[model samples]
Target chain A: MSASLPYAVHETAGHDNASMTTVGFWIYLMSDCLIFAVLFATFGVLVHSTAGGPDGKGLFELPFVLGETMLLLVSSFTFGAGMLSAQAGRKKQLLAWLAVTFVLGLAFIAMELHEFSTLIHEGAGPSKSAFLSSFFTLVGTHGLHVTCGLAWLIVMAHQVVRFGLDGIALRRLACLSLFWHFLDLIWICVFTFVYLREFL
Target chain B: MKAPLPHSGMEHAESHAHGNLKSYVVGFVLSLVLTIASFGTVMTDLVPHASRLATIVILCVVQLFVQLVYFLHMGTAKSQRQNTAIFACTSLLIVIVVAGSLWVMHNANVNMMPMSMSIQSALKHP
Candidate 1:
């Protein structure tokens, strides 16, 4: 139910058809969604395959992960605020919001990296069991997306500074909004089926 | 209720999408409430293990819809009928990819086990 994105830089010079960029980006997000779906399926199938290793229950810290979740949730809200400021043509406010969002996003990634490192340190690394393997694949992949998103946020903020909120900036902003919020959506599943399920 | 979902109209629908502050507040608050409730459901001894899983799953789905409406502006995007339809198809594929793989792999795991044990024992165990 979407179309067009900001004109791509590589499109033939005259073929700067800006109309399809957003929709095309939507399709790209859906395809990424499918990739997550497969990883999630792998996790579900092998969730019990711990092979005598430490499973999720003993490995996860609920409060710490909750802190991480809240960070991402608030970052999402901040990004939404950035989008609103952009919509109202308040470029400075938008940039401020983006800065808040970038820090929060960075914090979330830091916590995730910390979590992964701690696990690896304890000899509970991905190679420890099938469960760990699937766990790392699914959660690491999400972490990877957040990293790319933060990079995009940086580039977009720079573009906004240089170009103002021109057609290209607005289009890119809209896509980044989707990308950021979409990560939050995926995290809901991760927290539910991955983290919270340890208690289950 | 139906029409030739024009492309420009679709772009305008998506481009102008982001719902305002009130919606964002509602989505944010509702999401936190749902998330806390999910954690509480597991940590507190209030619910039995059997029902705990189901309860959290339900809460997760509800929170998802809450975010979709308030955060992603799905309500606004409804005007983009084709996009919505494509989204529906994508959701279907997600269900199949996840559920379908689990089902196939599970049965295969059971059936493909070594046959050294008695058939009755194997069947009972699997």
Candidate 2:
């Protein structure tokens, strides 16, 4: 059976270039999910302990968090559209969608950082309370990821412009797609268990 | 090596993408509205105090599933089976670690305070 194989099979056997980048990025996302899982676990364990300090009910602002959630959700959709545009080989549309995603992500981070600063200024710093510490750590870690994602988006935008729809650019875009979607996944958990859990 | 020809179903996939975008926008809007409604429930104290927390938690969980399915497309693709499995396992582990630890530690806190208070009194009078 091995001896009777077609030559075309042999020729193309070693050239399976089906984008490995997507697979690699998926693996990265799994690992990142694990990281978020660990943080979520930590927050869950400590959220109610509060060490005689203020609790989630006293500190959370549902309206502001709703705005932040909306911003990130919109950004994730725009990023998805950007990926679709790239797959359709529409470079200009892809760039425009990416720019929208980048701006929205930046806005999210800005609002988050402002919230953190205002909380600290009002004597709700992490050091003052266990609840505040876990709250900030969980939310701050996400904000940091968004900041990094925005930076990555800027770099990828330049690459897309400089190299149009080349394979490398496509790979980068695929990786960004995974990262952006992964962030959205984690935020859903955060919003549900951490922020909304307060109202419960 | 030459690039492979564009798949024969490229146009179909493009149309599918457009449809997916429309669905995603609709989902986003619904989630936003649900989130706002949940906040309103909390702010207005519409529900009885005892059940208010449970109601908000249930709403949040429902909204979370909505976002995951409509926005993230979790478990939607054959190729993503492994990814879905990993996520499910990690989530289970998280639940165990977090909820388990909270229960244990809270019980410990309740049980140990009396012992500590007795010891403090003994020491003070001695």
* DockQ in order: 0.40, 0.29
Q: Which ten residues in a row have the lowest lDDT in candidate 1 chain A?
A: A1-10
Model 1 has fnat of 0.62
Model 2 Cα lDDT, one tens digit per residue, A1-200? 12122111222222223224455566677677777777877787678656556777777788888888888878888887887788667889999999999999998998998988988887888997677888888989988899999999999999888867765676577678768867876886787778877875
Cα RMSD over interface residues, candidate 1:
5.2
* CAPRI-style class, candidate 2: acceptable
After superposition, which runs of candidate 2 have C-alpha atoms over 4 Å from their true positions?
A: A1-20, B1-19, B114-126
TM-score of 2: 0.79
Task: Please give the range of 10 consecutive residues that has the lowest summed lDDT in model 2 chain B.
Answer: B10-19
Candidates in order have lDDT scores of 0.83, 0.71
* Residue B67 lDDT (model 2): 64
Local accuracy of candidate 2 as per-residue lDDT tens digits, B5-123: 24334332112212355556766787778777676776776776787767777776777667655655555344344555766776687667667877787787687656445544867
Error of 2 at A193 (Å): 2.9
Compose the digit string of candidate 1's lDDT tens values, residues A30-80: 899999999999999999888779999999999998899999999999999
Q: What TM-score does chain A reach in every model?
A: 0.91, 0.89
